[model samples]
Target: MKSFAEIRRIAIARKGEHELAARMPGPPERPLRDLSDDRVLAEFSRRIFQTGLSWKVVDGKWPGFEAAFHRFDIARNAMMSDDDLDAHLRDTGIVRHGAKILSVRDNAIFLGDLARAHGSAARFLADWPATDAMGLYDLLGRCGARLGGMTGPYALRVLGYDGPLLSKSVVAALNMAGALDGAATSKAARVRAQEAFNTWHEESGVPYAVISRTLALAVPD
Candidate 1:
């Protein structure tokens, strides 16, 4: 793998320093403010609902979603009766997809369970090491409903966790760097990819989020 310095230089040339800086994820000191178990579940729900759908549409209807789901309060949403979910089927304000709606309730249950097991969902996420992003993703896949694929990491990003997300651009950059054979989807591949990022973090003394953004910016869109 190319040194992070070399990769960052290439990214600066390709995207310009200003643009690259803008695209970079925030430092750890700046938390994704107002994060709570409920908000985390809300962001997870947002990502799940946006899958294979128009993000624009989903974003525009977010208020309705907050209202419909009681702002994704973990306890309230976990207790969402079958009738409540059924009511959303006809609610035009938000997306009417049945499976996604069900996933929200499922995810709420997941978060509630986590709270019971580990104080709160926020504490669990806050305590996880950003360097082990793949490990955290694995945990999310197991404990959180419908948090497979990129959804888990993307949700983490949205919730202000400073970690690497295997976004398309980042994955392409990793492939170019010979970090892995292809997309790092399988468990073994993901583990290898996470180790690469950890190495970069060690080399640069930079946060994983910044290293991830730098690598992504190094690649052409």
Candidate 2:
């Protein structure tokens, strides 16, 4: 694999120094102490809902979603009846996809379970080792509904966690480095990608989020 310095250099060359600085994922703006499970659930819900649809559409209706889902209160959402979720299907204010709407309820249960086990879902996530982000990703897939693929990691990033986001650009950079082939969705490919990132993190001491973004920057737009 190419060194992160090489990747950063290429990124800075391609995007220019100023733009590159602007593009870096950076550290979380707010303190993690202030974040709550409800916010984490909300962000995860947003990321899952955005899949296979225009993000602009999801962002536009997020306020409606917050209202409809009772601001993502974990216990309240888990307690929502089938009839309550069904109402969202007929509600024009939100995306009417049945499975996606129902996923919210399922996710609430998932978070509630995590909360019961780990004091809170946010605490579980916070305690998860950043170096083993893939482990957390795997756990999310096994435990949470619709959290597989990129949803879990993307959700972590959205919730201000400094974790890697394995976007196509990052995948392309990995492919170029011979760490992955084809899509990085398969188990073997994912394992290889995780190993590569882990090695890079150990070598450079750069946070996974920055390493991921730097790798993505190395690839052409």
Candidate 3:
């Protein structure tokens, strides 16, 4: 495995190379403020939730998803009729997997309930205490939320959550922080990754959004 320094060197070397430009998908250049709308936030979460699926597929089918899910209106989706769900499952543009679609709807309902209980999703998430890796993994397991892995936490980090999120971007950020070697593999890698993030935030004079964009673009599909 390459050391964190080695990975950084590779990343720096590839930064402006024509070949890399051709191969690397650039992150969306739009400012994070543009993505702060509730609808946009829902879409962003949906995209991340659809990780295993191709972005091309997701983008192309987004219209179908939007129509099917009432444009992802949390309140409306929470009360979706069975006919609505059936129609969604029948739609060819979006992923028609029954369970996956159901999960989306279920998550919406759950999110609504959470909001009602906690006041707001943002507040709920914010109020949730910061946690370490094992703690996060356990929480996900308890929630019966599928598709989240160690990488899920990192994804949250890149998404700008104040608390822990274990996703690849976090891993890369960790390497940049020198908390973990780029190639380092261990349970403690996550903790080290968090430390690295803190350091980068302090020294790089760059915002998390920029760092996230850089990291997202660096990832190979």
lDDT of each: 0.86, 0.84, 0.53
lDDT tens readout by residue for model 1, 141-192: 9877889888988888767787798888888988888788887878998888
lDDT (Cα, 0-100) at 36 in candidate 2 = 78
Superposed by TM-score, candidate 2 places the C-alpha of residue 35 at a distance from the truth, in angstroms, of 1.8
Model 2 lDDT per residue over 85-198, tens place: 778888898999888887788889998888898888887787787777888899999988899988988888867676677898999999877778788888788878888888
- Residue lDDT tens for model 3, 1-221: 22433433455565654554454333444432333234533543465546777768777777777777767777776676788778877888778877777666665765576568866654554344443334544454455234356433443443444443445664564455455676434556655654554444555544443443444334442
**Candidate 3 clashing pairs, residues 3+ apart or interchain:** 4-182, 153-165, 153-166, 154-165, 154-166, 154-167, 155-167
Residue 51 of candidate 3: its Cα lDDT?
Answer: 72
Candidate numbers, best lDDT first, in rank order = 1, 2, 3
* Candidate 2 global TM-score: 0.92
Better of 2 and 3 by lDDT: 2
